[model samples]
Target chain A: MEFQSCFDIIGPIMVGPSSSHTAGVVSIGKFIYELLGDYPQETNIVFYDSFAETYQGHGTDKALLGGLLGMNTDDSQIKYALEKAKECGMQYQFEFENICEYMDHPNTTIVTAKRDDHVVTVGGVSLGGGLSKIFMIDDEMVSIRLSAGDDFSILAKPYQRKEKVLVKAI
Target chain B: MMEIQSMKELIEACEREKKSISEMMLMVEAKKSGRDEDTIIRMMEERLIKMKEAVDSGIKDASTAPSGISGGDAVKMSEYVRQGKSLSGDYISNAMSFSLATSENNARMGVIVATPTAGAAGILPGVLFSLHKNDGTPYKELVKGLFTASMLGLVIANRSFISGAAGGCQAEVGSATAMAAGTIVELKGGTPQQVVNATAIAMKSLLGLVCDPVGGLVEVPCIKRNVIGTSIAFSAADMSLAGVESRIPCDEVIEAMYKVGKDMPRTLRETALGGLAMTETGKEVKERLFCRKS
Candidate 1:
């Protein structure tokens, strides 16, 4: 089942306008933050389909940025994430698309982030009711469910890139 | 325990165990997660508190949302209900005001529990708190009601969908209303079969509703729809409790919802290209918002 827990249906208390658009997107961004071990200094985000169309009203942009800055789903500071990102000197740009070549879901995003000299690309989809899935990491397709109470840092460990591979790629 | 994947299986489990739907859900959740019942109960209690906080805050706040399309209506509804002039009586009117409060809170980006989803977040809280207000149902009982709601929602989510972008408003608000109907029945001591029938009836009522949020904001039709869903939940619950039966089973209703959503045009499935989203006023709202952003 896509939705496994009672919390998947009733919990994930979050700043709202939407659960799938805002709260689920936050989990995906936080997964990327955990993968990088820190907030990336530079990033490019691509929103697909419904996310692309309604990101503004739903605050999907702020939700993703807040999570990338290590904020949780319920963080009130999400409302001011754009200003916070600017103050932190985090360079970011957004692109929109009608369809994602990599994922079939409407609420999908691909984030490419760089911290120091380490760079990573992540593909994620918000699967409604505050559930999310990390579908791709560094061009490799992987399946990781980012549920509400999951320890993202612990989950990201197995997917962490080796220092040797990073050095060679750089 | 075999996993309860369908309404039939769920009813059978409840009968075989001789437990209420909420009790069955709690047991299944405990077994599946390997967590102690106390811990699970505590977690659900926390969510209940958050939902209450959202309703409490939204009821008094008269400020508008960022889009300026919604807000203050919750305050108006609360005030109207206070005057005791409502035609729908205490249960439904109170539920309507509470639903408005929660959805208004959602539109303002306030913290709220997504009872299935944020778009339909208002319906459960609306009905639960109304029960608390009118019938003196304790907070502890309301927490059990949440489990009942989640159990029904889980089946709908698995068998069909629960996100507007994935299916339509029928999946989002429709599922939440169905869950609310079943929750009400369970809270009111209805049988497991009656609870599922209430769920089926509620789902069938909202089967073909579209997700066409004006300006792509969760205001306008969304908040109002959530308010109306509470009444439907109550109606369905009352019908089931009075020994009424749904013509179609709960599982089949869910299947039909899924099929209809799949056949729906992408434009009506939250793309804002059709339905009320394409109205002149709706187009004006979109232009106004985007123009300000640019």
Candidate 2:
């Protein structure tokens, strides 16, 4: 089952509007932040299907940006993430698509980010109730479940890209 | 040690252990998370505190949401309910106002706990607080009621779905309402069988509901639907407590909901492409909002 805990149903106190669109999306973005060891200086985010249709209303853009900046789900600063991104000199762009070529979920996003000399593309899906799954890293398919209370740094360890190995695989 | 996968299994486990639904849930959670019972209870209490904070703040605030489409209704409802002329009595009237308060706060990007999903977050807290206000159900009892709600929600979520994007509003609001109904029954000293029956009754009422948020926002109908869902939960709980049984079993109803959601069109499933989202005024609202943003 995708849902395992009581917290999965009744908890994850968060800045809302939506769980699938905002809270869960934040966890996916935070997963990327942990993967990179910090916030990336640049990001290109593509939202698919339902997320594309309602991103503006649900503040999905702000949620992802807030997570990329290492904000938690309940962080009040999430509402001002767009302005904060601009002030921090983080360059970001958003694209909308009818379908994601990589993931098969309605609430899916693919983010390609660049930090220093490193660039990575990640695909994630928000699976409702502040739960998420990272389905792709670079060109490799992987499965990593992200819950709100997870220690993302430790979760990111096994998937952390080895520069030389990644280059060879690509 | 037995895995409670269906409503039948859940009821059976509760009987076998001579435990209430909430106690069974605590046992299961303690085993799955490897956390102590005290820690789990503390965590749930934290969420309950957050839910109460959202309701308290929203009841007093009259400001509109960022979209300017929803707000101030909670204050209006709270004021009206205070007059004590409500037709639905204290339990349901208080619940409506509380539901409105929580949903309005959610639309404003305020902090709230998701009961299964954020789109349907208002219903449980709405009913729980109303119960507390009407009968003096202690906060600790309400916290246990939350566990009862979570147990029912977990079954529906795994057996069917709980996100609107995945299964339409039937899966979102419908699931939350079902959980609330079961929670109410359990808190009122109903049997586990009665709790599952109440859940079934509530879910059956909203079976074919669609997710059609106008302007692609969770305002407009979403907030109001949460308000009405409270009454449905109360009615279902009362019915089940009176020994009424669902014509169809709870697990079968959940399976049916899953099938219906799978057959639902993409346009009706939170894409804002159909239903009320496609009405004339809906288009106008969408245009106005986007035009202003751009």
Candidate 3:
């Protein structure tokens, strides 16, 4: 491709103790929460590959649980999500398994949740460069590949419901 | 007979074209100035023509070498590159000295790329040095390769994010190595096609490489990964120059990387709860380190 005076520089001013571990999981968890349509009394998250391996050390568990608890990407409560999970009375457990078995990427996670009868199983892939894609939801695969720029909603087609509640970015 | 396509050829073409454009503009500007217009135009034309000839010659002589490092080894190597030596080599030794002489009070964040996040930031230098020293390549071409690689990285960032915690090391060391590989190939005078090929090869080879940092730090495995990444990048460049096409396109590989990362269990990505971190050594290291730090 011929170079066309590209001038899009992302400045560094983010709220994060760690951009990848903390913020990324928050985004994925928040996206999952969005897919679920409503808050669940119970959540069972099975972190495949990389997600399960490092969730505790990276605080991904907290990020995911905090996000499900309606926390934003920059929520300070994320540090306390594990302890608070019990206080808030939200039931959750993180497990691990090789989903694809042969692929090289280790940052894949399949989050399945049930809000009463509304069950949602969404697959989120965190491709490097702070970008991620939600590939599936509730057995029905969602083609929500994360592209450059803000196309979050457009990618969330399968998750869209009449009563879908959109949470504001934090 | 028509000339074969090569990276050197393409870059030289672009350079020649750029020179021609510059010369033409200079002539137009000189004409507007209304003095010594013919002299200025002639000089610019001559310069442009010389550049074109050089580009043509450079394209005819490009060879490459393949990387032998494995997917995991690449990551380890990248980490090693980051931790600069106490003293050695031209580029890094100087950079290391400068880093040491400079006080931490006024230090800035160095984008280590696929290198070690801290301690050593010499992977790029190492890759560039190897390309220049081992391949007998010119310095200017290296700059162009770096520029091209940066552009590719921007595209990836535009398309997706490269955070290790978010996307695992595939985003961190993985993307950085890919970026480095693309640059290396470009420097080797590979075609844009080869540049893309090198990128895919690097990314594909490093697909699923985890960010299992021991003791929850960017040290250890992280530093080693940087060294490996630089080596892999060099190898990728060589492979591309040798006409090895990475069957998958870079974009698709990137997408697949994302998909595969999504399927990865959280343990391996940087939570320090999987892989080596989960091992006995990892646990002991973490216990000792965290206890000391706290």
Candidate 4:
């Protein structure tokens, strides 16, 4: 089951207008933050389908930025994320699309971000009730479930490619 | 201790374990996450505190959301309820105000718990706090009520859907309303069977409801629908308490909701392309908002 815990249904305790559009998107952006181990200096976001249509009303932009800045879903600082991004010297842009080629869901976003010399592209779908899944990492199709309760660092470990380690194959 | 797939199985699990739904949920959480009961309850209690904060702030703040479409209604409702002019008793009127408060707070991007989904967040808090106001139920019991709510919501979400984008408003608000109904029954000392019946009744009432937000905002009809959902939840709880059994089983009702949601058109499912979103005022609001933004 995609939803395992009772809290998944009852409590993300998020700043909201939507669980799918806002809270779930926050998790996806936060996933990137955790995976990258730091906030990106520059980022590009593509909001797809319903996310593109009603992103403003739902505060989807603010939620994503808040997460990218390492804010949790419940952080009210989401409302001022755009200003905070500027203060932190984090450059960002948003592109709207009717569909995300990586996923067929209505609530989808693909983000390309740069942190120093390392850059990664991540695609995600907000699956509602503050639940989300990472579908693509650097052009490779991958499935990683991200709920509010999960250890994001662990869930994101498989896709985190830092300095290449000498492999001793067993 | 196995995962539950249906209400029948859930009840059987509860019966076999000789525990209340809340107790069963706690056990399940402990087993699934490997966390102790105290830690789990503390986490839930923290969420409860956040819910209280949202309701307390929302009822007092008369300011509008940045979108300028939703705000101040919760304050107005609260004042009206205080004046004792409402036809519905203080219980329901209080719930309406609370529901409005949380939903308006949601529009403002304030922190609140998503009982099933944020779009439908207000219903559970509205009903729960109202129960507290009218009956003086302790906060601990209400926290347990949230567990009961999650138990019901988990089944419906797993069986059907809970996001408007995926299943229209019926899945979002409808699932929340059903969860609230069952929760109320369980908190009031109703049987597990009764809780299931209440859930079925509440879900059946709003089957096939569309997600049609004006300007693609969670304002307009969405807020009022949440307010109405509290009444439906209370009514469903009362019916179940009074032995009003749903002719259709809870699991089947959830299946029907799934089918209805699957059959819903893309335009009606948060696409802002049909239903109230396509009405004259809805279209005008969209245009006005777009023009302002551009």
Candidate 5:
């Protein structure tokens, strides 16, 4: 089951107006951060369906940005995540869509993040109760469920791709 | 090694192991997470503390949220309750005030535990805290009540959905109320079957409820619905404890909720394009907030 712990339903201890829009999105961003091994230098976040529709009221944007900045779901900084991102010089942009062909869920986002010369694209859906699942990673359709309080970094390691490096004889 | 897909399975597991629903959940969690029981209990205790903190801060702080649509209702409710003139008795009225407090805190994006989901966060805390206040239930027992609530929520979530975007208010508040009902029953020494019955009865009461938030925020109807959910939870739990059985089973009720949500119009979901979001007043609120921001 995607939800394995009692805490999965009862806790996540997050700053939130909505768990699916806020806390779940944070876990998705956190998974991207884990896959990249750090916060991205520049990121393009595409919000689909419900996420695009009510992001402002629910603070979905702030939550996602907070996660991309390497903050956990419960971090109070999520309220000021935009300013924090600007301070950190973490370049980010948002794109909205009526639907995501990559996924059927309304609360979905495809985040393309770059750290140094390495880049990874992850598509995730917030499945409510602060549970999220990554449905796409770099064009590969993969299902990785992220429960709050679990170690997403370790959970995302297998999906991490080694960037190809070229060395010329000096 | 029992696989729990439905309330029936959960009840069967409880009977087979001679354990309470919370005990069953603790065992399953211990096995699934490979963590010691003490560690898991400590984690739940931490969540309980956060929930208490939110209620404590909210009942006294009447400041408006960023949207200015919701705030101070919790404080108002607490004042009304303090005057000793409530019709729903101290337990239900106190729960309502606490639910309002917790939900108001959630609307402000203050720290709180999502009892299944943040929009429905207030109900569990409202009920649990009221139990503690009125009946002198200890913190340790309250933690076990959380485990009981989670076991029921896990089944509902796995069977259906808990997000308004996926389902509707029925799924969010409804699932939380169901969890709360079961929790109340478990805490009151009800049987596993009674807990499931209470859950079913509570969920059935809100089967087709929609999630039409005004201005797309969790304030407004969201907070009030959470407050009402606690009363429903208490009523459902009382019925279950008194030997009332749901005509429809808990699993079937959850399945029906899932199917109804699938058939729900997108406007009734979290999308701001329809339902209360499109109301004249709702549009005005959105316009005011938008203008202020821009």
Candidate 6:
């Protein structure tokens, strides 16, 4: 196995609270938002596995909502995201599923968001040390990782079959 | 029946393995840096100095620990709530504050995990400190213990999984607890087998621990969870040392944790929409502390 550098794992800048719970959640939300390509008219988030049990305690609700609203991981507004969602007229709901019963990682989230004629569904996992991977998107199934300083809008486009793509955070 | 091995043999093996693995990792790092031995040693020496300073501070904090167990103690009390005994929130809060204060102070010296953010940085360190204190372990052992724990984490990073948003608290606290358990076993002179078993125990116990923080802050239940995670690490180590075997391996345990976390709903995985955050009391606190326009 290839040993990873600390910098490769954690990244440059992060906010308080947690990398997995706070930053990872925001990154996942941002990725979903970018995938939708616009502000979601409504979002239906299902917290599977660990997300279901502890989402409330981890501020993931606000963090993910903030991300859907185009908030950065470090935005302090993430704390008031539920209220912000209400203020912005964004509709969202929370539900718990027995993701654990299927024998999976405890920290998994499946987000499905819909905008005008556009709907995106994805699953994300928040690896510790400020790392995360978008395992699936729109049921097309792709693995995408967003690091610090990454722009999801540009990177979300699927690479052409003939195009050479190297996995490096810019 | 299987033959029982001597504890000294187990300790020596762990020491040798830890030394070799750590040396190998450092060599890899050195190769990547393309730096000479002198520079590498100098850098390592500087890091060692910092770690030593943090350990000194930990000792000082332990020396001045309040009467009764501390924040971790309240968490432990909470575990036994079913026995009809409970601690007041003020007492629990004090313990958590003490743990947080010590961890934040340590972070300044660059010692703790600092996780995805720095404010909750104390959780990992507080857990480590509590484990060592409760076990009557030596300071040097604790330092080496962190190294062992980090090694397990490095392996997980290499192999399958470790993420909170990805895997929930299983990856965060679960990973930390697993690392802590492995490190504690190594500190207690356990063999690799025991270390892995301890790690598996830790991971399994908190397979679905969520990353929820109230008002998007790392305070609230987060502090208590850290304190509790440490105690869990201690028991895991002790149990593994006492010949408890996990039916599942560490890697599989981690994988299960990931799968379980993935299946969890957003409400439980840090959304703050469920659990204590969604309670009447939680809503009241949110309104009182966070509702500025109200």
> In every candidate, how many clashes are there?
0, 0, 66, 0, 0, 65
Off by over 4 Å in 5: A164-170
Global fold similarity of model 3 (TM-score): 0.48
Clashing pairs in 4: none
Candidate 2 residue pairs that clash: none
lDDT of 3 by residue, B1-294 (tens): 212123334335446555321232333335443547555444333322332222222223222101111123222322444574323443333222222211110011112121111212234445654555555666555444444554555555545445665556776677767877876766655666677788889888889887677755444465456656766776787789999887777788878877877776666667677776668877887776556533
**lDDT by residue (tens digit), candidate 2, A1-170:** 88889999996889989999999999988988888888989999999999999999999999999999999999999999999989989999999999988878899999998877778899999988888899998888988988898899898877775743564686
- Candidate 5: count the clashes: 0
Positional deviation of A151 in candidate 1, in angstroms? 0.9
As for DockQ, the candidate ahead, 2 or 6, is 2
The estimated TM-scores of all candidates read 0.98, 0.98, 0.48, 0.96, 0.97, 0.54
DockQ comparison, 2 vs 4, better candidate: 2
Ten contiguous residues minimizing lDDT sum, candidate 1 chain A = A161-170
Residues B139-230, candidate 2: write the lDDT tens digits.
99999999999999999988899999999999999999999999999999999999999999999999989999998898978999999999
Every candidate's lDDT: 0.93, 0.93, 0.52, 0.90, 0.91, 0.57
Sorted into a CAPRI-style docking class, model 4 comes out as: high
lDDT by residue for model 1 (A1-170), tens: 88888999997999998998999998998988988889999999999999999899899999999999999889888889999999999999999999999999899999999888888899999999999999998868999999878899988888775633665777
Q: Is candidate 4 or candidate 6 better by TM-score?
A: 4
Per-residue error at A158 for model 1, in Å?
0.7
Model 4 over residues B1-294: C-alpha lDDT tens digits? 579989999999988888889998999999998999999999999988988899999999999987788899998899988998999888789999999999999988888899889899999999999999999988999999999999998898888899999999999999999999999999999989998999999999999999989888988789999999999999999999999999999999999999999999889889788999899989998898888877
> Between 4 and 6, whose lDDT is larger?
4
DockQ of each: 0.89, 0.88, 0.07, 0.80, 0.84, 0.14
DockQ of 4: 0.80
TM-score of chain A of each: 0.96, 0.94, 0.73, 0.93, 0.92, 0.82
| Candidate 1 interface RMSD to the true structure | 0.7
Compute the lDDT of residue A167 as modeled in candidate 6: 16
Which of the two, 3 or 6, has more TM-score?
Answer: 6
